[model samples]
Target: MASELPMEEIVRRGARTNFEGLRESSFVPLFLTLWGRQASDDHVRQQLKRHYESVTDHLVGVYADFFESQGWDPRPPFTIRDFAVTLTALVEGLTVRWAVDPDAVPLEMRSVQSSMRVERQDDLDAGPWDLFGIVVLALIPSMTVPRIKRDSELWADHEDVRGLVRRLRETWESMVGLSPPAEAPDHTAPESADHCGAEPRRT
Candidate 1:
């Protein structure tokens, strides 16, 4: 099914779902213990490795789809594959951490206390943000960059059109946690015409 949710929302939901499972599931630790014991048997260890690798492969595909949907590319610092691996490892580590010290890793953010304001009932039930969601949102900007379509033909030469495009690009960059550089890029430069409009977006 196609998701109408924005990239940030998708990341938030995915992270929270993982956090919920890690925190609430009773069988996870038991399964981990059983899986650990199987590591002593070479044949079982190989099978387990294959299973985990398959799961990682699935996560990679999910990330690929997410990036495509967002018109984003993996930034220079890391590849999409690297992100999938890191996220998987993070979940594993966080699962152990949560089990050991639930107090340290809370499921939701602490409520703000304001003496002047009365709490709304909806606010309590909304469940808008979580620690896992916050962490994922913070990492997204570093992990990916928006695909800026710079071909002159794709953009009209009119000042109004150009200004609108620039604003849109700025908004996109900001959404991904990027700060505008000291100098703005000259999108109209003739030498920069890359025939980008004709080419498929890079993942």
Candidate 2:
């Protein structure tokens, strides 16, 4: 099903859908509480652990498909598994923080405001799900870098991911009627730099 959509669209849709589920569902918190309290119960712990693993596995499969659709290989030094685990951890951790204190992080409020502006709506009308989606979007890029950098060769071919992120940010800016930021200078080394010396010279 994810194959039908562009990677960017798939990411946006997935983020929004999952964000909504997390925000509106009490079952998530209930389950987390149960896991925390029942950690010493082997049966309960095993069940919860399996459930979490299954969910992360499914996310890895989706990411694998997305990478394949873009002609990118989802394998070591960092694989879809790595991406999935990291992404899920970020989402879960942030959701807990937001649940505890919506304004615990100033970025959370800023993301909500940015999303509202993009939607051309007031905060009251935006709803918690919309704010959650905004937070996910804001967090995805930074989380992606570690996986991308793990294999420089693979990353070179998949550099489009960076551009895609930039475009997404620009889209939000345009929606909110703001000027896009100036492009930063490229500081990346040339392919041949690897052969030049042990360390590439700075430009």
Candidate 3:
């Protein structure tokens, strides 16, 4: 049956169909799907550090596909590090008033010390910057990043996307807010002070 229809046609058909029962779908199947495709999935419990060294590309592709599949089109024009900053801003934006206080969203995780320095055994060397490069590995999966400018046609046409991201953000905002504000995009890479040492972007 699967072979009877072309893959793209099947996906389009699914898009048009009125199938039900997917509202409460779990994420395990999806994550396992990406991991299954990459033989070097070190996220497996107790993976040695060396395993990550060989699978960086696999991980990045897995995450990139995850984001694109979620309709986060028109990606930012910056390095993965910059993209991380933008993504963080988007996911953690919107400072709402606390349920009781008239001042602002209570900084629940801001004051009491919420592991300032999380140590990952593998640099797998992934850093905070990896957030932009790898959305799939977020502590929680999301379809959008808050605060980041989503393009002109967005604010009006993408209410569903906006609502999804807004709620995802609000849900997490009380827990741990987004890092940097979506003020502006950074064009240069931090390590590019020596641009004389590298090549240029094709675009």
- Which candidate ranks first by TM-score, i.e. highest? 1
Where in model 3 is the C-alpha error above 4 Å?
Answer: 1-50, 73-138, 141-203
The 10-residue segment of model 2 with minimum total lDDT is: 118-127
* Candidate-wise lDDT, in order: 0.67, 0.60, 0.36
Candidate 3: pairs in clash: 90-145, 90-146, 90-147, 91-146, 92-178, 123-126
Q: How close is candidate 2 to the true structure, as a TM-score?
A: 0.52
Clash pairs detected, candidate 1: none
Give lDDT tens digits, candidate 2, residues 14-116. 7667755776778778878877867688888888779889998899888776665655564334566777876777667667877788675333344344444
TM-score of each: 0.58, 0.52, 0.20
Q: What would the per-residue lDDT of candidate 1 be over residues 1-203, giving only the tens digit for each residue?
A: 26665455567678888878766878567758768878677776777678778878998898898888877777655688888878877776777787889777777665522321224454333345566677777677556666764464323223333454576688789799998778886768765335655565588
lDDT of 3 by residue, 86-174 (tens): 43333223111222342443222233223323344432221122111122223222333434445543333335444555655666766
Using lDDT as the measure, name the better of candidate 1 and candidate 3.
Answer: 1
RMSD of each: 15.3, 12.7, 20.4
lDDT-based ranking: 1, 2, 3
